[model samples]
Target chain A: MSKQEQLQQLLGELKAALPELKEIIVASSDGLPVAQLGESEIATRLAAMAATAHGLGKRIATTTHLGNLVEIVIRGDQAYFIAYAIGDKGILGLTTPAGSNLGLVRLEAQEYARKLAGIL
Target chain B: MEPLKIVITGPVGAGKSTLIRTLSETEVVDTDAIATEAIGKPTTTVALDHGTLRLDGHLLHLFGTPGQERFDFMWEILAEGALGILLMVRADRPETLPVARNILDFIKSRAPVPYVVGVTHLDQPKVWQPEEVALFLGTPLEHTQGLDPRRPEEAVRPLVRLLELIGTNA
Candidate 1:
Protein backbone atom coordinates (compact mmCIF):
# COMPACT_ATOMS: atom_id res chain seq x y z
CA MET A 1 0.00 0.00 0.00
CA SER A 2 0.97 3.66 -0.34
CA LYS A 3 2.77 5.45 2.49
CA GLN A 4 -0.21 7.71 3.15
CA GLU A 5 -2.56 4.74 3.34
CA GLN A 6 -0.22 2.94 5.65
CA LEU A 7 -0.03 5.95 7.93
CA GLN A 8 -3.81 6.25 8.06
CA GLN A 9 -4.22 2.57 8.86
CA LEU A 10 -1.70 2.79 11.67
CA LEU A 11 -3.48 5.80 13.16
CA GLY A 12 -6.80 4.04 12.83
CA GLU A 13 -5.52 1.06 14.75
CA LEU A 14 -4.17 3.25 17.52
CA LYS A 15 -7.45 5.14 17.80
CA ALA A 16 -9.42 1.89 18.03
CA ALA A 17 -7.18 0.58 20.77
CA LEU A 18 -7.52 3.74 22.84
CA PRO A 19 -11.03 5.16 22.63
CA GLU A 20 -10.26 7.38 25.57
CA LEU A 21 -7.95 9.48 23.46
CA LYS A 22 -9.37 12.89 22.62
CA GLU A 23 -6.79 13.74 20.00
CA ILE A 24 -4.11 11.96 17.94
CA ILE A 25 -1.59 13.35 15.49
CA VAL A 26 1.17 11.70 13.47
CA ALA A 27 3.67 14.34 12.35
CA SER A 28 6.94 14.25 10.50
CA SER A 29 10.14 15.04 12.38
CA ASP A 30 10.21 18.42 10.65
CA GLY A 31 6.93 19.61 12.18
CA LEU A 32 4.33 18.81 9.52
CA PRO A 33 1.06 16.98 9.99
CA VAL A 34 0.86 13.59 8.27
CA ALA A 35 -2.33 12.04 9.62
CA GLN A 36 -4.56 13.14 12.45
CA LEU A 37 -7.71 11.98 14.23
CA GLY A 38 -10.01 14.33 16.08
CA GLU A 39 -9.92 18.14 15.99
CA SER A 40 -8.66 18.81 12.48
CA GLU A 41 -8.25 22.52 13.15
CA ILE A 42 -5.50 21.98 15.70
CA ALA A 43 -3.56 19.26 13.86
CA THR A 44 -1.06 21.54 12.15
CA ARG A 45 -0.16 23.61 15.20
CA LEU A 46 -0.14 20.56 17.44
CA ALA A 47 2.07 18.68 14.99
CA ALA A 48 4.64 21.46 14.98
CA MET A 49 4.50 21.56 18.78
CA ALA A 50 5.03 17.78 18.86
CA ALA A 51 8.21 18.13 16.85
CA THR A 52 9.37 21.00 19.03
CA ALA A 53 8.71 18.99 22.18
CA HIS A 54 10.52 15.99 20.73
CA GLY A 55 13.51 18.10 19.74
CA LEU A 56 13.75 19.67 23.21
CA GLY A 57 13.22 16.31 24.88
CA LYS A 58 16.07 14.74 22.95
CA ARG A 59 18.38 17.60 23.88
CA ILE A 60 17.44 17.41 27.55
CA ALA A 61 17.93 13.66 27.58
CA THR A 62 21.37 13.87 26.02
CA THR A 63 22.46 16.72 28.25
CA THR A 64 21.40 14.82 31.40
CA HIS A 65 22.48 11.35 30.15
CA LEU A 66 18.98 10.01 30.51
CA GLY A 67 19.42 7.61 27.61
CA ASN A 68 17.24 7.95 24.49
CA LEU A 69 14.05 9.87 25.10
CA VAL A 70 10.96 7.67 25.20
CA GLU A 71 8.17 10.20 25.52
CA ILE A 72 7.13 13.74 26.58
CA VAL A 73 4.10 14.20 28.76
CA ILE A 74 2.41 17.49 29.68
CA ARG A 75 -0.22 17.34 32.40
CA GLY A 76 -2.95 19.95 32.15
CA ASP A 77 -5.96 20.67 34.27
CA GLN A 78 -8.39 18.83 31.98
CA ALA A 79 -6.27 16.65 29.69
CA TYR A 80 -2.83 15.18 29.11
CA PHE A 81 -0.70 15.85 26.03
CA ILE A 82 1.82 13.07 25.43
CA ALA A 83 4.23 12.74 22.49
CA TYR A 84 6.43 9.75 21.63
CA ALA A 85 9.22 9.62 19.09
CA ILE A 86 8.60 7.23 16.20
CA GLY A 87 12.10 6.10 15.40
CA ASP A 88 14.01 8.94 13.72
CA LYS A 89 11.49 10.36 11.26
CA GLY A 90 8.18 10.97 12.97
CA ILE A 91 6.27 11.41 16.25
CA LEU A 92 3.00 10.17 17.67
CA GLY A 93 1.01 12.49 19.93
CA LEU A 94 -2.08 11.74 21.99
CA THR A 95 -4.42 13.79 24.13
CA THR A 96 -6.16 11.93 26.88
CA PRO A 97 -8.56 12.87 29.64
CA ALA A 98 -6.75 13.92 32.79
CA GLY A 99 -8.04 11.02 34.92
CA SER A 100 -7.30 8.25 32.37
CA ASN A 101 -4.89 5.39 32.98
CA LEU A 102 -1.60 6.94 31.87
CA GLY A 103 0.43 3.79 32.55
CA LEU A 104 -1.63 1.68 30.14
CA VAL A 105 -1.75 4.49 27.60
CA ARG A 106 2.00 4.79 27.59
CA LEU A 107 2.48 1.05 27.05
CA GLU A 108 0.13 0.92 24.04
CA ALA A 109 1.29 4.21 22.56
CA GLN A 110 4.96 3.24 22.75
CA GLU A 111 4.27 0.00 20.90
CA TYR A 112 2.30 1.84 18.23
CA ALA A 113 5.09 4.37 17.93
CA ARG A 114 7.55 1.57 17.19
CA LYS A 115 5.22 0.18 14.57
CA LEU A 116 4.85 3.64 13.05
CA ALA A 117 8.61 3.91 12.86
CA GLY A 118 8.69 0.75 10.78
CA ILE A 119 6.02 2.07 8.42
CA LEU A 120 7.31 5.62 7.96
CA MET B 1 28.03 39.39 33.80
CA GLU B 2 24.26 39.62 33.36
CA PRO B 3 23.31 38.55 29.87
CA LEU B 4 21.25 40.88 27.71
CA LYS B 5 18.55 38.78 26.08
CA ILE B 6 17.97 39.55 22.37
CA VAL B 7 15.37 37.82 20.22
CA ILE B 8 15.71 37.37 16.43
CA THR B 9 12.47 36.60 14.64
CA GLY B 10 11.05 36.72 11.11
CA PRO B 11 9.32 34.69 8.41
CA VAL B 12 10.65 31.44 6.93
CA GLY B 13 14.03 31.50 5.19
CA ALA B 14 14.81 35.02 6.39
CA GLY B 15 18.20 34.05 7.90
CA LYS B 16 17.30 34.34 11.58
CA SER B 17 19.28 31.18 12.45
CA THR B 18 22.21 32.19 10.29
CA LEU B 19 22.54 35.61 11.93
CA ILE B 20 22.61 34.14 15.43
CA ARG B 21 25.14 31.51 14.38
CA THR B 22 27.30 34.13 12.80
CA LEU B 23 27.31 36.45 15.81
CA SER B 24 27.59 33.85 18.56
CA GLU B 25 30.96 33.52 20.30
CA THR B 26 30.23 29.98 21.49
CA GLU B 27 28.60 27.01 19.82
CA VAL B 28 24.94 27.60 19.02
CA VAL B 29 22.18 25.37 20.42
CA ASP B 30 19.85 24.91 17.46
CA THR B 31 16.73 22.76 17.17
CA ASP B 32 16.61 22.25 13.42
CA ALA B 33 14.46 19.55 11.82
CA ILE B 34 13.66 18.32 8.32
CA ALA B 35 11.19 20.49 6.37
CA THR B 36 7.99 18.88 5.13
CA GLU B 37 6.73 21.97 3.33
CA ALA B 38 8.18 23.86 0.38
CA ILE B 39 10.20 26.35 2.39
CA GLY B 40 13.09 26.49 -0.20
CA LYS B 41 15.29 24.60 2.26
CA PRO B 42 15.55 21.02 3.46
CA THR B 43 15.66 21.94 7.14
CA THR B 44 13.92 24.43 9.43
CA THR B 45 14.22 25.59 13.02
CA VAL B 46 11.40 23.92 14.97
CA ALA B 47 12.02 25.31 18.42
CA LEU B 48 14.66 28.03 18.99
CA ASP B 49 18.33 28.72 18.34
CA HIS B 50 20.38 29.88 21.29
CA GLY B 51 23.81 31.46 21.26
CA THR B 52 25.97 33.81 23.30
CA LEU B 53 28.22 36.72 22.46
CA ARG B 54 30.30 39.28 24.34
CA LEU B 55 29.78 42.52 22.45
CA ASP B 56 31.77 45.50 23.71
CA GLY B 57 32.23 43.70 27.05
CA HIS B 58 28.49 43.19 27.52
CA LEU B 59 27.26 39.61 27.52
CA LEU B 60 24.47 39.03 24.99
CA HIS B 61 22.19 36.01 24.98
CA LEU B 62 20.61 35.52 21.57
CA PHE B 63 17.40 33.55 20.91
CA GLY B 64 16.13 32.74 17.42
CA THR B 65 12.51 31.76 16.86
CA PRO B 66 11.01 29.50 14.19
CA GLY B 67 9.60 31.31 11.15
CA GLN B 68 6.36 29.45 10.55
CA GLU B 69 3.15 30.78 12.07
CA ARG B 70 2.25 27.34 13.38
CA PHE B 71 4.94 27.90 15.96
CA ASP B 72 3.68 31.33 17.05
CA PHE B 73 3.41 30.02 20.57
CA MET B 74 7.19 29.96 20.68
CA TRP B 75 7.50 33.65 19.72
CA GLU B 76 6.06 34.78 23.03
CA ILE B 77 7.92 32.20 25.03
CA LEU B 78 11.26 33.29 23.61
CA ALA B 79 10.39 36.99 23.59
CA GLU B 80 9.70 37.01 27.29
CA GLY B 81 12.53 38.51 29.39
CA ALA B 82 14.11 39.75 26.18
CA LEU B 83 15.61 43.23 26.45
CA GLY B 84 15.62 43.83 22.70
CA ILE B 85 14.49 42.28 19.44
CA LEU B 86 16.07 42.09 15.99
CA LEU B 87 13.40 41.20 13.41
CA MET B 88 14.98 39.96 10.20
CA VAL B 89 13.39 39.86 6.73
CA ARG B 90 14.52 38.75 3.31
CA ALA B 91 14.98 41.57 0.81
CA ASP B 92 14.58 39.11 -2.05
CA ARG B 93 11.21 37.83 -0.93
CA PRO B 94 8.87 40.78 -0.67
CA GLU B 95 5.93 38.42 -0.18
CA THR B 96 7.08 37.69 3.36
CA LEU B 97 6.86 41.31 4.49
CA PRO B 98 3.25 40.95 5.54
CA VAL B 99 4.08 38.00 7.70
CA ALA B 100 7.05 39.86 9.03
CA ARG B 101 4.87 42.79 9.94
CA ASN B 102 2.43 40.53 11.72
CA ILE B 103 5.22 38.97 13.71
CA LEU B 104 6.55 42.39 14.60
CA ASP B 105 3.14 43.53 15.75
CA PHE B 106 2.61 40.35 17.72
CA ILE B 107 5.92 40.54 19.54
CA LYS B 108 5.70 44.27 20.15
CA SER B 109 2.22 43.94 21.60
CA ARG B 110 3.43 41.29 23.99
CA ALA B 111 6.99 42.28 24.81
CA PRO B 112 6.94 46.02 23.98
CA VAL B 113 10.73 45.89 23.78
CA PRO B 114 13.01 47.93 21.52
CA TYR B 115 13.33 46.26 18.09
CA VAL B 116 15.21 46.85 14.84
CA VAL B 117 14.53 45.39 11.41
CA GLY B 118 17.41 43.64 9.66
CA VAL B 119 16.91 43.22 5.91
CA THR B 120 18.93 40.28 4.67
CA HIS B 121 19.60 38.89 1.17
CA LEU B 122 20.43 42.36 -0.16
CA ASP B 123 23.48 40.86 -1.86
CA GLN B 124 21.14 39.25 -4.36
CA PRO B 125 20.00 41.18 -7.43
CA LYS B 126 16.46 42.58 -7.76
CA VAL B 127 15.90 42.71 -3.98
CA TRP B 128 14.39 45.46 -1.90
CA GLN B 129 16.80 47.78 -0.13
CA PRO B 130 16.66 48.51 3.58
CA GLU B 131 14.87 51.83 3.10
CA GLU B 132 12.06 50.27 1.01
CA VAL B 133 11.54 47.45 3.46
CA ALA B 134 11.38 49.97 6.25
CA LEU B 135 8.85 52.05 4.35
CA PHE B 136 6.65 49.03 3.72
CA LEU B 137 6.97 47.84 7.31
CA GLY B 138 5.98 51.30 8.62
CA THR B 139 9.12 51.45 10.74
CA PRO B 140 11.52 54.35 10.96
CA LEU B 141 14.22 54.19 8.30
CA GLU B 142 16.86 54.68 10.96
CA HIS B 143 15.59 51.57 12.73
CA THR B 144 16.08 49.40 9.63
CA GLN B 145 19.26 48.43 7.83
CA GLY B 146 20.59 45.83 5.36
CA LEU B 147 23.11 43.16 6.26
CA ASP B 148 24.55 39.86 5.08
CA PRO B 149 23.74 37.18 7.62
CA ARG B 150 26.67 34.93 6.71
CA ARG B 151 29.27 37.55 7.65
CA PRO B 152 29.87 38.33 11.32
CA GLU B 153 30.85 41.95 10.69
CA GLU B 154 27.69 42.62 8.71
CA ALA B 155 25.33 40.48 10.79
CA VAL B 156 26.25 42.20 14.05
CA ARG B 157 25.28 45.67 12.84
CA PRO B 158 21.57 45.20 13.48
CA LEU B 159 22.17 43.79 16.94
CA VAL B 160 24.41 46.72 17.72
CA ARG B 161 21.69 49.05 16.50
CA LEU B 162 19.16 47.29 18.70
CA LEU B 163 21.40 47.68 21.74
CA GLU B 164 21.73 51.36 20.96
CA LEU B 165 17.99 51.72 20.78
CA ILE B 166 17.50 49.89 24.08
CA GLY B 167 20.07 52.12 25.72
CA THR B 168 18.49 55.30 24.37
CA ASN B 169 15.00 54.22 25.55
CA ALA B 170 16.32 53.24 28.95
Candidate 2:
Protein backbone atom coordinates (compact mmCIF):
# COMPACT_ATOMS: atom_id res chain seq x y z
CA MET A 1 0.00 0.00 0.00
CA SER A 2 1.07 3.57 -0.59
CA LYS A 3 2.40 5.42 2.50
CA GLN A 4 -0.62 7.70 2.56
CA GLU A 5 -2.91 4.71 2.36
CA GLN A 6 -0.96 3.06 5.16
CA LEU A 7 -1.24 6.17 7.32
CA GLN A 8 -4.96 6.29 6.63
CA GLN A 9 -5.26 2.65 7.63
CA LEU A 10 -3.40 3.30 10.83
CA LEU A 11 -5.68 6.24 11.62
CA GLY A 12 -8.63 4.00 10.98
CA GLU A 13 -7.24 1.48 13.42
CA LEU A 14 -6.77 4.18 16.05
CA LYS A 15 -10.29 5.47 15.59
CA ALA A 16 -11.62 1.97 15.90
CA ALA A 17 -9.75 1.42 19.17
CA LEU A 18 -11.00 4.65 20.76
CA PRO A 19 -14.39 5.60 19.43
CA GLU A 20 -14.53 8.55 21.83
CA LEU A 21 -11.63 10.15 20.07
CA LYS A 22 -13.32 13.02 18.24
CA GLU A 23 -10.53 13.72 15.81
CA ILE A 24 -7.06 12.68 14.73
CA ILE A 25 -5.03 15.06 12.62
CA VAL A 26 -1.64 14.72 10.99
CA ALA A 27 -0.26 18.23 11.03
CA SER A 28 2.96 19.76 9.89
CA SER A 29 5.47 20.46 12.60
CA ASP A 30 4.49 24.06 11.96
CA GLY A 31 0.87 23.06 12.82
CA LEU A 32 -0.75 22.98 9.41
CA PRO A 33 -3.18 20.13 9.15
CA VAL A 34 -1.91 17.61 6.62
CA ALA A 35 -4.61 15.00 7.15
CA GLN A 36 -7.59 14.97 9.48
CA LEU A 37 -10.42 12.74 10.65
CA GLY A 38 -13.65 14.36 11.86
CA GLU A 39 -15.42 17.64 11.07
CA SER A 40 -13.62 20.17 8.94
CA GLU A 41 -14.24 22.98 11.40
CA ILE A 42 -12.67 21.14 14.26
CA ALA A 43 -9.73 20.10 12.14
CA THR A 44 -9.14 23.67 10.94
CA ARG A 45 -9.14 25.11 14.44
CA LEU A 46 -6.91 22.36 15.75
CA ALA A 47 -4.48 22.80 12.91
CA ALA A 48 -4.04 26.48 13.69
CA MET A 49 -3.70 25.83 17.40
CA ALA A 50 -1.21 23.06 16.83
CA ALA A 51 0.89 25.27 14.60
CA THR A 52 0.86 28.08 17.12
CA ALA A 53 1.72 25.71 19.93
CA HIS A 54 4.53 24.20 17.87
CA GLY A 55 5.88 27.62 17.06
CA LEU A 56 5.78 28.60 20.69
CA GLY A 57 7.51 25.37 21.62
CA LYS A 58 10.42 26.14 19.29
CA ARG A 59 10.76 29.65 20.65
CA ILE A 60 10.90 28.34 24.20
CA ALA A 61 13.51 25.76 23.33
CA THR A 62 15.82 28.32 21.75
CA THR A 63 15.62 30.82 24.58
CA THR A 64 15.80 28.39 27.51
CA HIS A 65 18.72 26.40 26.16
CA LEU A 66 16.82 23.14 26.59
CA GLY A 67 16.85 21.11 23.34
CA ASN A 68 13.68 20.34 21.35
CA LEU A 69 9.88 20.48 21.41
CA VAL A 70 8.42 17.08 22.22
CA GLU A 71 4.72 17.13 22.90
CA ILE A 72 2.03 19.37 24.40
CA VAL A 73 -1.15 18.49 26.27
CA ILE A 74 -3.88 21.05 26.92
CA ARG A 75 -6.85 20.29 29.09
CA GLY A 76 -10.17 22.02 28.51
CA ASP A 77 -13.46 21.90 30.32
CA GLN A 78 -15.22 19.76 27.72
CA ALA A 79 -12.33 18.32 25.79
CA TYR A 80 -8.57 17.90 25.74
CA PHE A 81 -6.03 18.41 22.95
CA ILE A 82 -2.70 16.67 22.81
CA ALA A 83 -0.11 17.41 20.11
CA TYR A 84 2.92 15.18 19.59
CA ALA A 85 5.67 15.81 17.09
CA ILE A 86 6.36 13.17 14.44
CA GLY A 87 9.93 13.66 13.42
CA ASP A 88 10.38 17.40 12.69
CA LYS A 89 7.84 18.16 9.99
CA GLY A 90 4.77 16.34 11.25
CA ILE A 91 2.61 16.25 14.38
CA LEU A 92 0.09 13.70 15.56
CA GLY A 93 -2.81 15.41 17.31
CA LEU A 94 -5.75 13.85 19.11
CA THR A 95 -8.87 15.55 20.44
CA THR A 96 -10.80 13.66 23.04
CA PRO A 97 -13.41 14.40 25.67
CA ALA A 98 -12.48 15.55 29.13
CA GLY A 99 -11.44 12.80 31.57
CA SER A 100 -10.22 10.50 28.81
CA ASN A 101 -7.36 8.26 29.84
CA LEU A 102 -4.50 10.49 28.76
CA GLY A 103 -1.97 7.77 29.36
CA LEU A 104 -3.71 5.44 26.98
CA VAL A 105 -4.28 8.17 24.44
CA ARG A 106 -0.64 9.18 24.62
CA LEU A 107 0.51 5.64 24.13
CA GLU A 108 -1.71 5.05 21.12
CA ALA A 109 -0.84 8.37 19.60
CA GLN A 110 2.87 7.73 20.12
CA GLU A 111 2.66 4.34 18.48
CA TYR A 112 0.81 5.82 15.53
CA ALA A 113 3.29 8.64 15.38
CA ARG A 114 6.15 6.19 15.08
CA LYS A 115 4.38 4.41 12.27
CA LEU A 116 3.50 7.68 10.56
CA ALA A 117 7.09 8.87 10.83
CA GLY A 118 8.25 5.79 9.02
CA ILE A 119 5.86 6.50 6.18
CA LEU A 120 6.16 10.28 6.10
CA MET B 1 16.79 29.51 51.16
CA GLU B 2 18.13 30.22 47.68
CA PRO B 3 16.91 28.01 44.87
CA LEU B 4 19.31 26.32 42.48
CA LYS B 5 17.84 27.40 39.15
CA ILE B 6 18.07 24.93 36.23
CA VAL B 7 16.58 25.49 32.79
CA ILE B 8 15.33 22.75 30.42
CA THR B 9 15.06 23.60 26.74
CA GLY B 10 14.69 21.63 23.51
CA PRO B 11 12.93 21.50 20.12
CA VAL B 12 9.35 20.34 19.58
CA GLY B 13 8.67 16.79 20.84
CA ALA B 14 12.07 16.50 22.45
CA GLY B 15 10.32 15.74 25.79
CA LYS B 16 10.92 18.88 27.86
CA SER B 17 7.70 18.61 29.88
CA THR B 18 8.26 14.94 30.61
CA LEU B 19 11.77 15.74 31.75
CA ILE B 20 10.48 18.50 34.03
CA ARG B 21 7.81 16.22 35.47
CA THR B 22 10.50 13.68 36.30
CA LEU B 23 12.80 16.33 37.74
CA SER B 24 10.01 17.62 39.93
CA GLU B 25 10.22 14.32 41.81
CA THR B 26 13.77 15.23 42.59
CA GLU B 27 14.63 18.14 44.93
CA VAL B 28 13.68 21.14 42.81
CA VAL B 29 10.95 23.77 42.50
CA ASP B 30 8.94 23.87 39.27
CA THR B 31 10.04 26.99 37.43
CA ASP B 32 7.72 26.17 34.54
CA ALA B 33 4.81 26.75 36.89
CA ILE B 34 6.22 30.12 37.78
CA ALA B 35 6.58 30.97 34.09
CA THR B 36 3.00 29.92 33.48
CA GLU B 37 1.83 32.20 36.25
CA ALA B 38 3.93 35.00 34.90
CA ILE B 39 2.20 34.68 31.54
CA GLY B 40 -1.28 34.76 33.14
CA LYS B 41 -2.70 32.11 30.80
CA PRO B 42 -2.75 28.36 30.48
CA THR B 43 -0.80 28.23 27.19
CA THR B 44 1.10 31.47 27.56
CA THR B 45 4.15 30.19 29.34
CA VAL B 46 5.90 32.28 26.67
CA ALA B 47 9.03 32.24 28.77
CA LEU B 48 9.33 29.44 31.33
CA ASP B 49 7.71 26.81 33.52
CA HIS B 50 8.79 26.55 37.19
CA GLY B 51 9.02 23.58 39.61
CA THR B 52 10.88 22.81 42.79
CA LEU B 53 12.45 19.91 44.66
CA ARG B 54 14.34 19.62 47.94
CA LEU B 55 17.50 17.58 47.62
CA ASP B 56 19.96 17.21 50.50
CA GLY B 57 18.38 20.30 52.06
CA HIS B 58 18.94 22.31 48.88
CA LEU B 59 15.88 23.76 47.16
CA LEU B 60 16.41 23.36 43.43
CA HIS B 61 14.26 25.60 41.24
CA LEU B 62 13.56 24.03 37.86
CA PHE B 63 12.71 26.25 34.89
CA GLY B 64 11.32 24.85 31.63
CA THR B 65 11.54 27.22 28.73
CA PRO B 66 9.15 27.27 25.79
CA GLY B 67 10.53 25.34 22.79
CA GLN B 68 9.90 28.04 20.18
CA GLU B 69 12.54 30.55 19.14
CA ARG B 70 10.15 33.49 18.69
CA PHE B 71 9.60 33.65 22.42
CA ASP B 72 13.25 34.40 23.03
CA PHE B 73 12.80 37.12 25.62
CA MET B 74 11.74 34.65 28.29
CA TRP B 75 15.04 32.80 28.05
CA GLU B 76 16.96 35.77 29.42
CA ILE B 77 14.77 35.98 32.49
CA LEU B 78 14.77 32.22 33.05
CA ALA B 79 18.50 31.97 32.58
CA GLU B 80 19.01 34.32 35.50
CA GLY B 81 20.03 32.57 38.74
CA ALA B 82 20.54 29.32 36.83
CA LEU B 83 23.51 27.30 38.10
CA GLY B 84 23.55 25.01 35.08
CA ILE B 85 21.49 23.85 32.10
CA LEU B 86 20.30 20.40 31.02
CA LEU B 87 20.16 20.48 27.21
CA MET B 88 17.73 17.80 26.00
CA VAL B 89 18.29 16.64 22.42
CA ARG B 90 16.12 14.20 20.51
CA ALA B 91 18.17 11.20 19.46
CA ASP B 92 15.72 10.47 16.65
CA ARG B 93 16.53 13.60 14.69
CA PRO B 94 20.02 15.00 14.52
CA GLU B 95 18.66 18.05 12.64
CA THR B 96 17.84 19.49 16.04
CA LEU B 97 21.55 20.07 16.53
CA PRO B 98 21.28 23.56 15.08
CA VAL B 99 18.47 24.48 17.40
CA ALA B 100 20.46 23.08 20.31
CA ARG B 101 23.44 25.12 19.23
CA ASN B 102 21.33 28.25 19.05
CA ILE B 103 20.12 27.70 22.61
CA LEU B 104 23.63 26.94 23.78
CA ASP B 105 24.89 30.13 22.25
CA PHE B 106 22.17 32.14 23.94
CA ILE B 107 22.95 30.58 27.30
CA LYS B 108 26.68 31.00 26.89
CA SER B 109 26.25 34.63 25.99
CA ARG B 110 24.14 35.23 29.08
CA ALA B 111 25.87 33.05 31.68
CA PRO B 112 28.94 30.94 32.27
CA VAL B 113 26.95 28.00 33.60
CA PRO B 114 28.15 24.48 32.88
CA TYR B 115 25.90 22.34 30.70
CA VAL B 116 25.30 18.63 30.11
CA VAL B 117 23.50 17.35 27.02
CA GLY B 118 20.89 14.64 27.52
CA VAL B 119 20.16 12.79 24.29
CA THR B 120 16.55 11.65 24.41
CA HIS B 121 14.77 8.83 22.45
CA LEU B 122 17.68 6.41 22.69
CA ASP B 123 15.19 3.57 22.39
CA GLN B 124 14.66 4.55 18.74
CA PRO B 125 17.23 3.28 16.28
CA LYS B 126 17.12 6.50 14.25
CA VAL B 127 18.88 8.27 17.10
CA TRP B 128 22.60 8.88 16.87
CA GLN B 129 25.14 7.66 19.36
CA PRO B 130 26.00 10.00 22.20
CA GLU B 131 29.66 10.17 21.18
CA GLU B 132 28.82 11.03 17.56
CA VAL B 133 26.27 13.59 18.71
CA ALA B 134 28.75 15.10 21.13
CA LEU B 135 31.28 15.37 18.33
CA PHE B 136 28.67 16.78 15.98
CA LEU B 137 27.72 19.45 18.51
CA GLY B 138 31.33 20.02 19.54
CA THR B 139 30.37 19.39 23.16
CA PRO B 140 32.81 17.50 25.38
CA LEU B 141 32.43 13.73 25.38
CA GLU B 142 32.05 13.75 29.15
CA HIS B 143 29.14 16.20 28.93
CA THR B 144 26.78 14.07 26.86
CA GLN B 145 24.76 10.97 27.81
CA GLY B 146 22.05 8.83 26.25
CA LEU B 147 18.71 9.26 28.00
CA ASP B 148 15.04 8.44 27.79
CA PRO B 149 13.33 11.71 28.60
CA ARG B 150 10.09 9.93 29.43
CA ARG B 151 11.65 8.16 32.41
CA PRO B 152 12.68 10.17 35.47
CA GLU B 153 15.62 7.97 36.39
CA GLU B 154 17.10 8.23 32.92
CA ALA B 155 16.59 11.97 32.68
CA VAL B 156 17.82 13.05 36.11
CA ARG B 157 21.30 11.53 36.33
CA PRO B 158 22.80 13.75 33.64
CA LEU B 159 21.22 16.75 35.33
CA VAL B 160 22.63 15.70 38.69
CA ARG B 161 26.04 15.24 37.15
CA LEU B 162 25.73 18.70 35.62
CA LEU B 163 25.06 20.12 39.06
CA GLU B 164 28.07 18.29 40.43
CA LEU B 165 30.21 19.59 37.62
CA ILE B 166 29.04 23.11 38.31
CA GLY B 167 29.89 22.69 41.97
CA THR B 168 33.37 21.45 41.17
CA ASN B 169 33.92 24.30 38.72
CA ALA B 170 32.82 26.85 41.27
Winner by DockQ: 1
Which stretches in model 1 have alpha-carbon errors above 4 Å? none
lDDT of 2 by residue, A25-60 (tens): 887553446778888887865764575565566666
The DockQ figures for the candidates are 0.69, 0.03
Please state the interface RMSD for every predicted structure, separated by commas: 1.2, 10.0
Task: Show model 2 residue runs off by greater than 4 Å.
Answer: A1-120, B25-45
The window of 10 residues in a row where model 2 chain A has the poorest summed lDDT is A47-56
Error of 2 at B163 (Å): 1.4
What's the DockQ of model 2? 0.03
- TM-score per candidate, in order? 0.93, 0.53
Reference contacts recovered by each candidate, as fractions? 0.58, 0.03
Docking class of 1: medium
